[model samples]
Target chain A: MKKPIRLINLGKTESWKTQAVYHALAEEMTDESPDTIIICQPDSPYLCLGYFQPFDSIFDRKNVELLNLPVYRRRIGGGATYLDENQLFYQFIFHHSRVPVALEKAYKTMLAAPVETLKSCGLDCNLRAVNEIEVNGKRVAGIGGGRINDAAVVVGNFLFDFDFEAMSTVWKAPWPGFRELAKDAVKERVYTLKQCAPNLRMRAVSDKLIELFPKYFNRPIVSGSLSQKEIMASQKTAQVLTDKIFLNDGNTDIPVQPRPLKISADVFIHNKKMFFKNKKINVSFRTDNDVITRVKVEGAVEIEKTIIGITIEEIEHILNSGSSTVLKDN
Target chain B: MSKKDYNFPADLHYDGKNHMWVKKENDNIVLVGIDAIGLDTLGDLAYITLKPEGTIVKKGEPIGTLEAAKMTGDIFAPVSGKISAVNAACVENPGIVNDDHYGKGWMVAIDASDWSTESTALISGEKLQPWIEAETHRMETQGFDA
Candidate 1:
């Protein structure tokens, strides 16, 4: 007989709380109960970037603020996602020995069940090489994970119910025009579960999940809650998440080499830096990349890159005008 | 229920503290970084700063930090001794803490002469289940339950 997988919905709590549960579950599987696969839902509306991405690029400053979001990153790696009530996250906790040793293959195989669920919703959702569920071409679901003793827990977010306007606003590329371009680029490629399954409300979507999950695993699905231990772990983790120095950090010395003609910002400093000229400004990049390093004013500030020249003008106006900190009155 | 499985590796060495083990590399120490259950439940790595090289930290002392985007975590020493080397790779890319938490992601290395005191808190392979369970229980009580 197959093992019964547990399904859980955080149901409108802070996004971090979802992570707290994941960690808690991982710990539980290892020691207390090694028999269950757990799923979760997160709270808040924000841009969640991949581990390899610099947050500034992943989050759209203007759009994020308009939504009054708490822009933050996650521990796993993958493309940034916009999560709101529009999305319901599902997580699977399992032992590695129980899974295939091949990381990439295992990730795809694990996500296949959800991919099918989304497909049933009517969208042309497709899984990609890295672990993204895309509609047409734009990603509707982002995935990532970690390993517990002989175990690997893979987690992902599905856009069952979400606000595209807010999502379009929160996520953007480093390139200013790229966002506008990407938006258009993504227009034909992406569609939400609501778009595909117009009749699927939050309740309906969840109900489908509750029913279909068991069939896929060929096992019973359990309705569960946080044990006393997991609650304590999340609380402890939450405290750590709130710390400033811990949440915002930087190690600028690790040389960053951006692509040619591209203006990549490394946030070890408070002033945002664009590769405008041969002269490198003495900007300190913050660890979070939300703030900037000081600007490196070189002799005449020659334009080594051409495109950013156009960007800096608009950037200057925004900085001079009222808004969020841009290179901070240097 | 918060599941805690020791899943500690058989090959890695330990430093005192609830943290687990890692093997020593040529000039750098490759640790599992943080245990699986440790970083995940804690949330994102908002900011993480390890003790700079040459800092003398006793075993189990606060060697550095592991911050989630929404939380803060202490990077406890994995060994008791003087800090001989560190993984600069992590200061640059903390996700390595997640990617290769135990392998390439090891945090720091200490040249320990006293294994009894510094290594006492560490566990490996089959021995890590109980503590993992304890930590999971701690998380469960704190709203980590789904």
Candidate 2:
């Protein structure tokens, strides 16, 4: 017989609490703890950083301060993202033994509920690659997971809506034009539930998830609230999540190349400035499934069209082939 | 007993539960890294962070974290020791861990405090093949290819 699971439906919570609740649960979990799922939405906006992402390298500190957004560094790994009430979060905290040993299998297992939930809402969505939920090649949900203490935590969001402008402004772009490029790339690649299903409500998505999770995991669900120990643990976890030292932990060294911003498993925006024959050139490009889909070149327009359909490896070969005139005739 | 898809080098000592391998550099100093099966299971690595040099860690405690595109997990120490040094190259270019996990991709160097006792727990030599086969079957059930 399968073990029973606990379900906590926190309709809305303070931004920090939404993140802290799951972290605390995972920290306090033991072998005997029931596998738990918490559904919640942050009452306000906040910036969440991946466990290994350096805050200074990924975010425009000035813009973040201007917006007065509280920054929280999650133990889970993924890129930094903006979160608000528009995105309903589903956090699953299970003992390591309960989840699949393989990360790919674990993701597919946990994400099955959300994917089915989206499908039930009359939207066509499926788990693409490992963890992404995409609708017609556009990503509809943001998912990330990792091991915390003895618990395997998978936290993902159902995007009722997304603030594209806030997302664009918060990131640290290499050049002034890079943000606009990123903004366009994300808008083109990410889809919201409202954009796909006009009448769907956040409550409906949460309710559907509650109904499907037990079926997927083959476990009976028991409606519950945070235990006294979990509440105390969350209070302490909140303090660490908001600390500045934790936010800047990943900034130990300056990155050599500005890392590409991954919009999805298959989409990324790369911005780099390189020297071509002593003339500095700014190159920004977008790749869809490893093939260059868009290109912007400040120093040479001819090379842009030539490299549009190629992979980054082919472009690097052309740039590093000891031929300064590679772009002259293109 | 090694499978065609994964490599379990005979020279290294493995903590099968944690998926870490240890190579003794000296009587007490050892280099540690994720085994081939662990690397394959993680898919492509995106980022990695190791504890700073000189941090004391107990056996089975986390020395750092490895982050792939979709998942992240702690890298546990196979034996109790102080982290003598961290592999800066792998931390800078995480892809190297996928490229050369046994050599330049080594995660950390530990100055072990109790190698004589702790080393016995790690699998090697005659015990290596059976451990790899068991782990392969275990992971395969969870959807790993091998």
Candidate 3:
């Protein structure tokens, strides 16, 4: 027998309302409560950061303060993104035991509805990676989730329109020159629905999703509204989300230590984190003009400017050799 | 243990519905952790946040939140108690839950405030065997095994 699901279409709401309501609904979930699907769009612009992401690591606090742009952190795991009214948000909240237990399989199953909706619109989108949708090798949508009380929520978006400049302003590169390339990368990697259809309305896309979700999930969708308890809980959550202290909880000042900075536009440092014998080793290095420029090991020991002109592969080989295992990277 | 294996030691008391195992460490303290089936089914772990060290937790109350890649599950107390200590290693590296769930991944230890009353609600021995096997079979039918 098909299961029952409650559909809450919160058409257009304040930037925080979309996050607050779904979060509150998830918090109040119990075994007796029906599964839920929330669809909405933010009316204003805001930068939403991931739960584990440190603010200063991804965004410039001074620029955020100067621009007076609002920012909030979600209890979800993923990178930050600039969200506005153009992106239609869908959050699927259900009991953890009610869904597939495998992570990759679960995400693919839950996201199939949105993917099929975009496919019907002639976007040729497919669920790629574990948590993203791709069209012609470019990401069209992003998905992430976390647990709240007894519910597991998988949240995703339909990218109706994207603001590249606004996105670049919030996301910071490790250094200058790379920031411009990073912005260029965003334009190169992400695509929007309007890029395919000349005059597709956000409402039309949302309607398609609403129509298709029932067929994909094989559940009867009964339209519903927030309960009184959910409303009061969301109001309380909204207050907590907008609090300034909550936003700046992990803010830190950058040290003036002389670091090997990115000198060229093409040189990009990849922060690779590996777990060897339950110990985390983080390595940061970049090739400058086809030559290894600098190697820095952070978060374990102070080995700054200790090794240079050696390729990352050679460093890996030496590290793996297990003879001189003194420097552990960040 | 095999990916399809179901192993709930007979000595450990379980809140079967919630899928938690509680092992009495002393007269008043009990060590709690998610069972192998729960760990195997919950996908890879990303983060685990436990209730603060000294907070009083009620039986069946959530003591921590576990975030897998796409889904999140709660870790509940099997008995009413005050959290005496938390596993620092598991919080630092949550992968241990998948790698060694029964050993190093033990989540918390509670100083049972009312051990006798709360302990009565837990299941063990004969009752736990059928419950775990049925739950495992149900999960396997849903395509959860690695």
Candidates in order, interface RMSD in Å: 11.9, 4.8, 6.6
Model 2, chain B: what is the TM-score?
Answer: 0.93
DockQ scores for all the models shown?
0.07, 0.43, 0.36
Q: Write the per-residue lDDT of candidate 3 for residues A100-168, one digit (tens) a residue.
A: 665666777678889898888877788765767877656777677766777778898988889888777
Model 2, span A1-330: residue lDDT tens:
556789998889888889999999898789899889999999999999888776887899999999999999899888899999999999999988777777778888889899999889877788988888997668988898988989999999999899999999999976755676789989988899888887999887888999998778777889999878888889889999888877876455323345788888878888756556677777778888788988887767776797689997876776667576343211
Question: What TM-score is obtained for chain B in each of the predicted models?
Answer: 0.73, 0.93, 0.88
User: Considering TM-score, which of the candidate structures 1 and 3 is the better prediction for this target?
Assistant: 3
Error of 1 at A210 (Å): 3.2
Model 2, span B1-146: residue lDDT tens: 34446788899999977888999997699999999888876888987878889999999988888788778888899999899999999988989999999999999999999999999999999999888888877766642111
Clashing pairs in 3: A282-A330, A298-A330
DockQ, 0 to 1 scale, candidate 1 = 0.07
User: Ranking under lDDT, best-scoring first?
Assistant: 2, 3, 1
Cα lDDT, all candidates: 0.53, 0.84, 0.72
Could you tell me every candidate's TM-score relative to the true structure? 0.56, 0.92, 0.79
